[model samples]
Target: MSKSLTYTLLFLIMMIWGFNVIAIKILVESFAPVTITALRILLAGIVVMLILGIRKEFRKVTKPQLIYITIGALTGILGHHFFLSVGLTGTNASNAGLILGLVPLMTALAAILFLGDKLTILRMIGIVSGLIGVSFIVLNGERSVGSISRGDLYIFLAVVTQAVSFIAIKRATETMDARLMTGWMQIVGAFFLFVVSSRLEPDGLSTLTTGTPVDWIVFLASAILATGIGHMVYNKAIHQIGAGETAIFINLTPFFSLTGSYLFLGERIMVEQLFGFLFIVAGVLLGTGALEQSLRKHKQKRMAS
Candidate 1:
């Protein structure tokens, strides 16, 4: 495929993931965070395995690769996404969206510390600016957890964990097919979440059975479309585009999530959210080289014409 087509497809994948943040928040209203996340992963993992298995590439995983896949699943699927869902239970959709913007910064930090990737001064500024914007959203927003927001710290932890997971994927990408790696990771992560839920929330399965049709639809969307397809696309994007570029698309997630929340969940956007969105957009535009790319593209088109 052409570069533009590849980037466009990846952009759409990222956009889908933004919608998922809202879907997951909706799912959490009816299910506990871990239970909801676990179920989604389990269902999505099954679908991914079936897809991979049909291609005859599913059984070729080596022992070391399996270990990496397990680790990746533990961090990315279990640690990151589960906590994110739980965090949504206490945070506003827009607040969560703002926090989600930090994924790229977190990824860049993880890359520098763990993956030995470049950490330019401009990148540091972008990361800090995004963090500052998130802080404004959190401090002024109504989310509170017993003197603190319930998911504030948890969601932050989730962001950090996801950053680490991104780096882990980057490392694994050197040796693994992004598809197989993601499929196995989700499968293994779902298993771990199942075990965790069994020990911690034994009532989870009962909750699933008790939910309404809307709940079921939300869960399925979260699992099948959001977690399965979205995450798979994310893994591929990271593999091909590298974490920094892939991470840039994440900044768009808050915009999609906020819009989804407003349309579906009856949530209203606040001034703080609007400002946060602007700062985040500006930061991301700088971080992703979008402004420069646009200008260059525009100049080329004009010159050509």
Candidate 2:
């Protein structure tokens, strides 16, 4: 319940999410994007259903809640995974890492516009900083203008869809249990992916047929640990605290993504990219009131002594 503890939870959730991106990229290489996304969510959904079923929670769902959950699954789980996987196919891992840094800013903007939350000057600055960070990453890559990679555009599409889903979840949370909502959403979304993947992917079933022990570990970690449990913790954290503070936790994603990419994929980070990463972190910290609060607390302690 303490602010410090809440922040720590948020940070851990972000690390899980960051690692997930790297895991997703690996899956994309070995499997069709849609196929992997579908299977992961479907498996996660089954796990969630089992958990809820044990608690007799599955029987309480009403008609309207079902509809809302369906929409949530489509927008957040389905659309988000589909676009992100599609994007990862065309873009470098580094670019995907950086582009995701904009989530907090986008979430804030969506909250303000759709959820009637106030957008303060600090958040405005954070939005600008995030945009600048996005620009730096895009330009630093020296990507072709006319022949922009399909992957990069897909990343942006993922962002837009995710923003919509976050706002929807925020509104839906007023009446629904976050866990139940998330579980159903994943189930419905997974079904959609399963159907689509079945048609587009030949030998798609084979992708999951064989893998090294490490591969299987990472895949389960991605689906169960990073996603199923990760989202549960995240929604809880955000529900306890406010979204602004929770959004700051997302700043950790790029750092984790970069580290995971390096250790797993052997990707090297350039100096410019590192600087951009720092700026993104700073922007998120400042935008979320974390930096300011820390400074204020430090100054107060100094003056008291």
Candidate 3:
């Protein structure tokens, strides 16, 4: 696996993820948000389980690991997906894509608060920048006060929940394989989502059968390619190249998502959204220490020279 090939694969994975937002938007047009999300997650979990079985990686989790995995399942899978699917119903995919770029910064904040990670000056700046960037998207260049939409608020909540889940995921992965944890989390999350959807959306399951062939295709691709295989490849890239290198690629996701929204859904991109993306890129670089690491390497090379 050459670096070039690995990078290309990562880029494609990001594209899949970006287009998945568009797929969700399309699916929500005909299916209930919670119902479709639950079904997709359930399918993704089964796919992951198949992969784990092929690799013979299944094992019993300790009580502590189970606790963390449960937390991750609830926050990352159940909470995040619920909000994101519902959010896309009330808002366009383009806005959701841009707003999700705040995940890295929010994760940084979560680490500082829950994991006792140090808050450096750069991180502080990054936090402010990311928040401002997301606010721009939420406001969508409107001059009127209170322009924030409910969907935008839900998207932000999704980011927050996912960020918190990262903390538990980190803990769980210390004593367990990430793939295993992910598989279990998805299964557990899907169960809860089913329960929730049944209570809130009595006709949700029936709506699944009402989708066209195209809708089913998009839904399957989003679940299998984006959620199932995408996660596996991403984790593999982290193992091969390192987490920092892999994380830098995440900055490309919003752009890919924006492009997908434009091409597939015919959504318009606003100037403010582009500007917000710039802030988000800068924030992720700073917030995730990618910028700091690059500077350190440069300084080291200069001293050696």
Candidate 4:
């Protein structure tokens, strides 16, 4: 595929993810957080399983692969959703978007710690800045400036789970098929959530029966567009080009998410929050070594001019 087309598709996918955050905040008005997250995971898992089964890629799993899948089910699926659903219930959708901007940075830090990836001086500074920025946002209360309510703590927890999951995924992708692992992880996570929700939330069983038409549409969109198909297309894009090329598009996710929140959900941007976001983003770029490449590109453009 041409570069332009690849980028266009990635852009569309990020838009879906961006819009998904807003959609969840809206849907939470009608559904419990646990209920929504469990249902979404279950539905997405079923869809991915059918697709993989049709492609004959759903091979019998080995014991080791099952272990990895189980770990991912715990961290990536169960922990991440629990944090995210609760976080969105009390936080600003825009805040969730900005805080999630830490994924690349957190993943890079995890890589350095666990995978022996290089951690440069700049990246160290970036890490510190990210810490300070996230702290400021999470520690501040609702009446405080640039505060995103106390729910920001849940978002940070979600980031921690995601960063850890990235490590698990890196190990799995070394030998296992990424899509299959993801599918199984989803199934495992969904089962965990279903059982837990059944116990914790009184009306969890009636989640489907309780939603209106709009809620169901939003729920399906969140499951299919933002997650199930989103991850599939993401992996395919990485296969077509490379992880780095695909990753530069991640910078767009926050922008799209914040914009969607602002336009659709009427979220207002805060200066302090924006600064914190920039700090976090800078940390991600520098920590991941993508900043150097960006600088090199700018220098080339200047020399060309």
Candidate 5:
């Protein structure tokens, strides 16, 4: 594909992921975090299964892969989204969006620690700096803020769970079909979420009925468009352009989320949050070696010229 088309598609995927935060915030206004996350994952899993069946891609799993998928469900879906869903209750969607920019760096750190990946001085610095940034923004320069609202802390921990899941997923997908693995993981995660939410929330799935049409619209849009379609297109883009090039677009997610939140929710952020977010973004770029890669290309072009 042309670079232009590739970038467009990539940005579109990021946009979906970014704006989904707003959708989640809307859902949280009425629905419990676990309830929305539960229903969303379950519905999205069903959608993915249907698509997989239509494409003749759905298949049975082995015993070992099942265990791996179960682990993935726990870390990726159960713990990750559960924390994120609950976290949004106390935090602004825009700041939560920015927190996601730490994924690349956190994922890199996870790989280094768990997968025996090497880390360099520059990358380490990036990781440390990124941590400081996340702390600054999440803490908002007040140690008391941590007590006032755990939304930031919950969201930060959600990323940690997600990063850990990436390692498990990497190991599991070595022999498994990526699509099948993802679909099954969602199914498993959704099942657990359903059970947990049903038990904890006395309403027991009544949240769906209690909501208005607009709520339903937002819920379905988030599940189908943001989670399902977004995942498919992102995986496709990664295959097309390679993971390295694809990652550059993810940084745009926070910007899109910020814009959407401001327009739709009339949300505003503190200057400290922006600074911390930039620190996280810069750290991610540096730790992932994306910054160095860009600089190398620019230098090469300059010398050639």
Candidate 6:
């Protein structure tokens, strides 16, 4: 794909994901979080499988790739979704969106620790800024003064699990296609979610039947557009453009999430949250090397001129 088209596609994908946070928040008001997550992920997995079947791109996984893929399924799919769903029960969608902005910073650190990537001074500064930004969001919860919110903590855990999952996914996709890995990971993760929901939420399955038509529409759209095809396109971007470049676009997600939350969920945007977002944007640009790369390109262009 041309660079402009690739960027445009990624921008749209981020918008879909941003709105997905609102979708989940709305769904959790009626359905049990874990149960709903299980159903959504299962449907998304089915969508991916159908796509793979139509394209004839499904391939058998070797033993080593299976190990990494399984790890990714557990952490990325099951763990991340589990925490995020539960977290949204207590936190506003606005806060949850800002907390998720930590993923790129955390993922960069994970790459350094797990993948033998270099740690630069800029990255160190970015990491500190990101953590400070998240602290503002977490501590500014709707509770007692200076007390951290449990919901914020769960969202942070979700970020941690997702970062770790990226490491496993990076390894798994070394030889395997990213789409195949995503399909298997989501399917396996959905299975585990089902088991967990069955154990902890015995009445959860019944709630699904009670949803209104509008609720079901939102649910299906979140599953199909946000989780299924969104992830597939994101993984493809990571494959084609490299992880660092792909991650820079993630900075756009929280802004979209903030807008969606304000418009759809009627959530207020706090000043502290806005400050947190500014720090996060700077951190991601620096952490992902996008700022450095941009400067380098501009300098080269100036010299050429």
Off by over 4 Å in 5: 1-3, 141-148, 293-305
Better of 3 and 5 by TM-score: 3
lDDT of 4 by residue, 238-280 (tens): 7787765666677677777778888998888776666777777
Instruction: Give the poorly placed runs of model 3, Cα more than 4 Å off.
Output: 301-305
Backbone Cα, N, C clashes tallied per candidate: 4, 0, 0, 0, 0, 0
Per-residue lDDT over 139-173 for candidate 6, one digit per residue giving the tens place of the 0 to 100 score:
66465545678888899999999999989988888
Candidate 3 per-residue C-alpha lDDT over 1-305 given as tens digits, one digit per residue, 9 for 90 to 100 = 88999999999998888888899999888899998999999999999999999999888899999899889989999999999999999999988998888887888889899988888899788888887788778777663446678898899999999999989988888888888888889999999899999998999988988999999999999999999989888877877897767878888889988999999989999998898899898898888776787788899999999
Tens digit per residue, CA lDDT, model 2, 7-91: 7777887888887888889888877778878988987877777777787776567777777777777788878888998899887
What residue pairs are clashing in model 1? 144-149, 145-148, 145-149, 145-150
Pick the winner on lDDT between candidates 2 and 3: 3
Model 3 residue pairs with clashes: none
RMSD of each: 3.4, 3.3, 1.4, 3.1, 2.3, 1.7
| Alpha-carbon local distance difference test for all models | 0.75, 0.77, 0.88, 0.80, 0.82, 0.89
Model 6 per-residue lDDT at 282 = 85
Q: What TM-score does candidate 6 get on C-alpha atoms?
A: 0.95
For model 2, which pairs clash? Answer: none
Candidate 1 per-residue C-alpha lDDT over 1-305 given as tens digits, one digit per residue, 9 for 90 to 100: 56576689777876777777787887777776677788788899888778777877666777777777877888888898778877988886767877787776676667778867666666567666776676667766564434657676678888888878866676676787887777778878988888888887888877777678988877787778777777677766666765445656776788888888788788888887878777776666655444555677789999999
Candidates by lDDT, descending order: 6, 3, 5, 4, 2, 1
Each candidate structure's TM-score, on Cα atoms with residue i matched to residue i, is: 0.87, 0.87, 0.96, 0.90, 0.92, 0.95
| 14: Cα error in model 4, Å | 1.1
Worst 10 residues of 3 by lDDT: 139-148
